[model samples]
Target: MNFQTSFPSLRKILVGIHDLGRKMAAGADLSHAFIMLDGSYGGKEIASSLVDEDPNSPKGMEQLKVRKPPRQISIIRHCVNTALLANSAELDLAMGPSRKASSLDGQSRFLPVFRSGSCSEIGPKTYMEDEHICIDNLTDHLGVGADFLSPGAFYGVFDGHGGKDAASFVCNNLLKFVIEDQHFPTSLEKALKSAFVMTDHAFADTRSLDRSSGTTALTALIFGRTMLIANAGDCRAVLGKRGKAIELSRDHKPNCNVEKLRIEELGGIVSDGYLNGQLSVARAIGDWHMKGPKGSTCPLSAEPELQKTTLTDEDEFLVMGCDGLWDVMSSQCAVTIVRRELMDHNDPERCSRELVREALKRNSCDNLTVIVVCFSSDPPPRIDVPKTRVRRSISLEGLHLLKGVLDSNG
Candidate 1:
């Protein structure tokens, strides 16, 4: 068999292979070509063969498993199917296709899946005046009839001044009041506004509690993809949208131009950035001593300003923190730091803890409370910074001027 004579035989073999590939590409069945081996698929080492196929399990059924994922992953939560599986040690946790992917394909929109973490510290303060709350599963906590959207969450950071009574009270009862209002589950904005005013009035009525104490309230409530932020006083809510800082709530301080005008219109005085030369914030709750009556408008208002936005894939997380954190750190800095931390390890609790630690390092003078709520279990993707080429050139006049100056000095 000379090499030149064997060329036609090799061409025949290659042609035959090409025809087989085309047939496979046309969806040809090749089940007979497959071989079963222990290393081929994830399963227990059972003494079984291809001939011993169980009728209960159809072809490709073994690939669909109901697996309990690792504890680190909190994003993929719901079980849409009623399949039971065993031998967790042998199978991967991918259970099935991504519910989020399927849901997006069906709805043609983005929906938020919320998970939160929080940390509070009495840093550099003798007494802790900051109180915060985190509720990841509002329906389970408040019952199913609460009318909240599925996959929802609520977060708040309360900064108490004068005492801890107001902050603690709001942290405990604010949500309850909001949910129990007549307008709740229907008009959330109205319900939230009324709840703030009512909470203040109720505090005024409670003789045992310190009505003179006050707190700045900031809350972030999410239902499906929509997020509503309510704020009064200086505590802030900042949304981390793909490493950029999007301020959700404005800091209501005495020195703000709008607040100053409002205060002056209401006959309130601002002296040295303090309203009425005593309180630092323009609006707050539980400061009944400064207010006139239950429903009457006053300089020191309890009404909260609300802001709402729909969360999208670009929206990564939300940062709700008292002024302690913002006093020393910029919102963009915090967002950048938190995004980096999440990408390193998708743990919001650790992210919040580290954020508090950062504020402490910055010498923040007040009590600190920070809540970090991530929208997905997966970490944020890295931001690709566009590379720029900066061409540096000097003018001939500048060079001549430099030479003249050198000659003069000589």
Candidate 2:
């Protein structure tokens, strides 16, 4: 049963061992030799063993005589096999043989594997909330004497609650109100204030509220050299400037200092950290029920914090969203994702659609709305010069001649 007898000569032995080593290195399991040699070959198995057999020697030792040199070579070969195992392990680790090991830490890696090239809704969620409106237009006439306003003059995120009515009203009428208000100030500051107040008044009389119909208002009006933002509700306005998030609107929560004081001052208490223990609006357009009694100063007031800053070329875009979208995604995260989409497709609407889709995929339950206004468009068209209608001509020639004759007489 001596397997070694199969290859008899020294040259044959060397060739067989070398070939076996090659096969082993080529991924053959070589460790089976020890068990096969011991179990299958007995004392009388080999001719060499039978001739030199000592019946008087210790049981199995007399039958086995492995030379020291070959044994050492076998140990080295096993070590080479061990090294190969270690290298295989390292290769597996480096190459990430499994897909799970290659994923990123955050949501970026989990962006839905889009089925169709066109952006579409994943669930029941729509890219736009029913209550929100977005408008970006080039003004026909620039406001200033010499400098002209960019055609991109408007951007809005209307967040409606208790129903989409308030948001819908603002979206439909906000721009028109601003345009028609003779009282609207020439400066963005005045214009924003006028627009917000007028929008609130416009909302008050639009429809009757059965439940509690109210909305968080966040609007951005871009004019020459200025970016003006006004916000009243939980909806947010964020500017992505130089790749960072600059929050333009403050969250008017019941727990906030100013909001808490205003709610309490109006004979309302923050119950469980919510206004009257129900709503969280410190300032909102509607909620006539929460307005408290007449002659009360604490009614739901539509005061908005107006912010204005001179926009620079570094200002990439503005993100306006309802609290639904912001609840899951950080302002910077939204900005980063939207900016990436815009840079890839150069479309603001696509960016908006994706922003909402990502929010919904993140498990946001509320109505999600997002608007991205990119200020990259053709310059506004020129304004028409005012026409002058001359009714009467001044008698400048007679006056000049009379002055000349008087001087000559003198």
Candidate 3:
């Protein structure tokens, strides 16, 4: 069925703030399933690629150093040498296979139990040009039968530049296109990549809208134990595995290595880190000014880079936010704060609120949005560091040498 016309034109009836506690419908009437995935069905978004990202997270990570040295206590026992290699957040946890739930026989015992919370604010900025959507239960949202093998939920953050129309349009329509894609539920990666381009194209074809306005899109779609993250532009997705920060999506900043190569390859010169000495992002949706012709092979692409991972017991929560929060805090810092908050209160809403507040306190220059999706209701357990042990022994020859040295001195 062509689901393109299923959703009527809903300009901005969505809730200003969204929170998902098991269900993402808090304070909003989204029973139509049109709020997050708003297009009728198989509706489109556009062209794509990585961006010159700067916020949510940097392509370059700032490693945390431990300033406090170990106290010089008298070593009564032999011990091995040890040093703190790096912070947990600085570590890049490897991504598991993008296989189906049935393929994860080992992780079969660990299914995702989602509870999400989100907050968006016009920090120091005058206008709120950011838009986002949170749906914890896609099965219910889609009105589909309960199938453990299908997609479970969806979340997205759209950061608009030039204007809010692009962000608003993408947020409302992107997911609908994904679910309505012919490859949906079976070939998720293909469906998502196709959906991103579709949404970008759809935005470009729309009439009565400013073609110049563009937005960076970051989306997280969870199916059973498999999570597929599609990102373009700079917004980021960081997964909290236990207490460690695991980056699920890369920031598509123009300064980023891969994005830079692509920009130069497409004849798009990035001057002062801006694409073609104009836009900051290398990729985006609805920037018809930069795109020119429909399939012109422009540098400002809208096609998203997809990252897939199988969720596990160690995976605790996922944080999706715009560059505002990231400009002030490191991914490690964000994860630490969220982990501590969850351990204390186990509330995703409070965590989201706290993250926004922290960013504002740090004097963020742009609009702020953050969504914290927890996999379990239980608070994260405290991470304990194991003590390092080593046994040191002296040989008989060493003892005799010491005695001979003492005798000579006497």
Candidate 4:
């Protein structure tokens, strides 16, 4: 069944801000769902008509019958007075506002994403096992295009072993490289491959400073309707889809055939069914000592499996973490807790903190990293790719366009 109506201006404006704020506050520990917009769902017309049109679109509209009268009335009012005004304000801001702000200067129509949260303790052990990084600048955005610019957003975790060098290296450069790659593929798969290889080489280049630094990486990239997920090592990604846990990525281990083959090809040995008879993980970013034989064709292959999935309403949120959090919590258990948290708190990052707290409570022994990607709001439309694609360096000028839209709408 379908029901159509216009949203009021003010209501539209506020919905955007309220939704963005909710997302920003959510961080990594919450569940989210997106609402799709049909061609018939006219924001401007809805905004203008909602103030006067009957709350009931059609007398026999069965769907409308099920909705509460107050909610229906409020929806119309919201669309007109807030949503529409905010949307217009955003567009005006994007186009370059001529006048100074007045009563509405403080108001933001677009909703930003939630901030991330974390915690750690000094255990009796002489060393530290927990590691983390939270960049609010990146979390609140997706990406932006001509038709619809998306806010750029990503989350990641690196579980370090041997030492903290690996994990720390990734947290510092992974996102920067991905965004800066001149050859970053428009396709998620290709882009991810490029990123993995580039990131590996970047580490190798840094060997001059510290050859032992390497990390296990699990990253989630959210842009438009595509969610690009890439992973190497044992870090895992599990999705909470419609309240059920769905494993989205594989955990590479020593026993896996691919890992075994790669290990042997790189001149690395497996003893006691372990990588070099030490680490149980088959794939990892660093560990030069465990890499290729003196002069073999094999090197520390950091090949990552890149998956691109078109998001839908059924897609809720994703949990990406080092084994620390996963070691202590089952996918289902994590989802349940996050789902409950979202009920009480709509922020994703706050949910992330709660996850870390839960892990610490369970006494996870490894350094922990967690990245959560929530599909809570309607994503902007896909960018149109020109038939004759011209590659241009993404520069400050190009980036400004993104900032402009985000500042206006997001």
Off by over 4 Å in 3: 1-106, 144-151, 387-410
lDDT by residue (57-124, candidate 2, tens digit) is: 56435334342124323333323346666886787687884544444333222211101112223235
Write down the lDDT that model 2 would get: 0.60
In model 1, what lDDT does residue 322 have? 93
How close is each model in CA RMSD to the real structure?
17.6, 27.4, 31.8, 21.2
lDDT (0-100) at residue 382 of candidate 4?
A: 26
Identify the superior model by TM-score, candidate 3 or candidate 4.
3
**Using Cα atoms with residue i matched to residue i, what is each candidate's TM-score against the true structure?**
0.69, 0.56, 0.68, 0.57
lDDT of 4: 0.59
Ten residues in sequence with the least summed lDDT for candidate 2: 111-120
Clash pairs detected, candidate 2: 138-151, 266-298
Q: What TM-score quantifies how close candidate 2 is to the native fold?
A: 0.56
- Distance from true location, Cα of 255 in model 3, Å: 1.9
lDDT digits (tens) for residues 227-343 of candidate 3: 999999899999988666678888887888899999899888888888888888888899888887776687889889999998898999999999998877777668878887898
Evaluate model 1: give its lDDT.
Answer: 0.77
Model 3, global lDDT: 0.75
User: Candidate 1 vs. truth: CA RMSD?
Assistant: 17.6
Error of 3 at 319 (Å): 0.7
Q: Which pairs clash in the backbone of model 1? A: none
CA lDDT of each prediction against the hidden true structure: 0.77, 0.60, 0.75, 0.59
Which of candidates 2 and 4 is the stronger one according to TM-score? Answer: 4
